[model samples]
Target: MPLHILDRLNHPLWPAARAIYERSFPPHGRKPEALLRRMLERGQAYVFVLANEDSQARLHPAAAMALAGPGGSGLIVDYLAVDPALRGQGLGSRLLDELERWALERTTASALVIETEAGAGKENEGRRVFWERAGFVAPDGHVHRYIWVPEPYAAMYRPLPGREGGLLPPPSGRQLFRWIEGFHARAYRGFREEE
Candidate 1:
């Protein structure tokens, strides 16, 4: 499988990739496809897919991921999902590896940051574990609750590869939060944080 950076929204495999994205996250957790299109058009965000090309040159997309930044100190993994039938095959980790390489080569992001649900009883522990295995770290006892979403979320980060392919220390929780907040303020204008 090869990782594809989606520069045009109308690519042949776009619908399939978008389907994977829509089904992966709940309505409250995802940005509208329209917004995504606008961001793509304006180069405000990036979308990636892992796919296979068959003999006739058609693409079969297996996973999709969207990202929001290297802006204001954060590179947010806004959404990521593998096809439901393709779970446990390490496609997600492959995608992350490709993404990290791409970011390292093309951008100067401090780290790759993501938000995972942290509320009790939310069945998100496995999700957190997956991130941990991919080298993301979150501070213990810290959760950010948004007003528009009921579940509390913890921000986790994997430091980008530093000079000579070494890993830098992860960014602080405050820096991670700022990156997420700055991106969301522009991308999710009406949403606010819980006081």
Candidate 2:
């Protein structure tokens, strides 16, 4: 499997990757396609599609992920989804692993962070478990609420390995929240938050 960084709408994998992204999240939970395009064009994000080669060596998208930051703040897992037909095959984990490597080798991010729904529900619980299995842990206190997102979310992070393979310390919850907020500010520049 290979991870393709799709930074343009004309990329060969864009259609499949976009379809998978649209189907994975509800409209309110996802950025509009136009905004996503702007993010790519501005180099504000890293959008990746995990692909596998077919018999003829043609690559087909299996999963998609996008992230921002790691530009001194931290790397946030903006969105990650395995194709509906390919769910339960551990492709999500594989993609995430590749993402971590990319971050480690390519940036100065101190940690890899994610936001999962905070309420009580099986879906939320399952998401938490999946991230936890990947070594992400929630901060001791705080359910971060964003002005634009209706659902309350909890922040989780796995500190990246530092120089000489030493582990970086986890960031404080306040710092993590700030990094998340900064990402939203940049990604949603023209949109206003509800009061």
Candidate 3:
């Protein structure tokens, strides 16, 4: 019940959600707010916020995620954040549960992809483990350099419909470039939409 789906970010809970996002992600991994706002306006993105049941709708979200389906398909979980104070209470997992539900039921995305920083550190390993527990598997290959960061990230994916064909066939070379462009291009597209 705390999972509140947002049509746009200009809502009472935005400050809380923004604060959590800022705190959860490092500077380089976070997207520009302007870019996210524009994406919402163009109907290319979806947002969901989680507020503690006791806090109700007035307080900022305890967790939040911003997922985008570029070109009317291909789910990209661009951001997922939980309030540092509220971490380890299973709130993050709950948020992901809601996110996956939306993508699988409300949208037609064939696969859900999450790009994670590649590393050998425990923190990085822990992050991957969390996703793995949720049925996500890191595909074999380097996805790309983070848009703002200089390191290579892995494109981990989970086929949402829960079958072999639910996956996006792995891409290579020119196909990989096109695959990456498909989602990144939408981020740069103008946000104009008819009323």
Candidate 4:
């Protein structure tokens, strides 16, 4: 049977969501389940589950994407993940489409924005291709540095009509640095500092 997508936060099958994420990104270096719970608690995140229509049991999450409220002028894609088993099955694209439709339903948002690593490594290259295929364009003049790594990363934005410049303002170096610091603090909260 085909899967149906639902928006139940307390769905019985929610626990498996983390396992699916772990399988896809084993070396992700962070626990996604904890973060997902936090996001959901904040009410800024949504979980879309793909399940069998007959029994409503989750087969697997075809795709999962979270959107934070409008930062400067647009919405930010806080996180996006798809089950590895469902990759390349058009589920990712469908999830993105639903996200856009969601944004359009909001009266205040004008565009959607997301950040991703830049350049040509296996992971980075694949991410770039996916965003490009989803209609995201890398802005010509913006670069944000990674907190853990010294290298800088590019920013990408997808302008929605009337919200072209409504998204978060481009970050300055000082601002970016602060962001990096915050990211590291949260991402490694319980880990001991290197001696």
Best by lDDT: 2
lDDT of 3 by residue, 91-178 (tens): 7678777777777787776666677767678887788888888777766655565465676667666666653464446533333334
Model 4 residue pairs with clashes: 73-166, 74-167, 110-163
> By how many angstroms RMSD does model 1 differ from the true structure?
4.4
Model 4 segments beyond 4 Å from truth?
Answer: 1-9, 26-32, 50-58, 61-69, 149-151, 165-195
Higher-TM-score candidate of 1 and 3: 1
Q: What is the clash count for each candidate, in the order shown? A: 0, 1, 0, 3
For candidate 2, write residues 1-195 as lDDT tens digits.
Answer: 688887777888878887788888998888777777777787878688887676623444545555454433567888998777778988888887887888888877767888789888999999999999988888767887777677888888877766323324546666677787777678778743441
* Candidate-wise lDDT, in order: 0.73, 0.75, 0.66, 0.55
TM-score-superior candidate, 2 or 4? 2
> Each model's TM-score?
0.85, 0.87, 0.80, 0.67
Per TM-score, the best of the predicted structures is 2
Error of 4 at 193 (Å): 15
Question: Model 2: what TM-score?
Answer: 0.87
Where does candidate 2 have its weakest 10-residue lDDT segment? 163-172
The residue ranges of model 1 lying beyond 4 angstroms of the native Cα positions read: 54-60, 163-170, 189-195
Q: lDDT at 144 for candidate 2?
A: 77
Q: Candidate 4's error at 51, in angstroms? A: 4.6
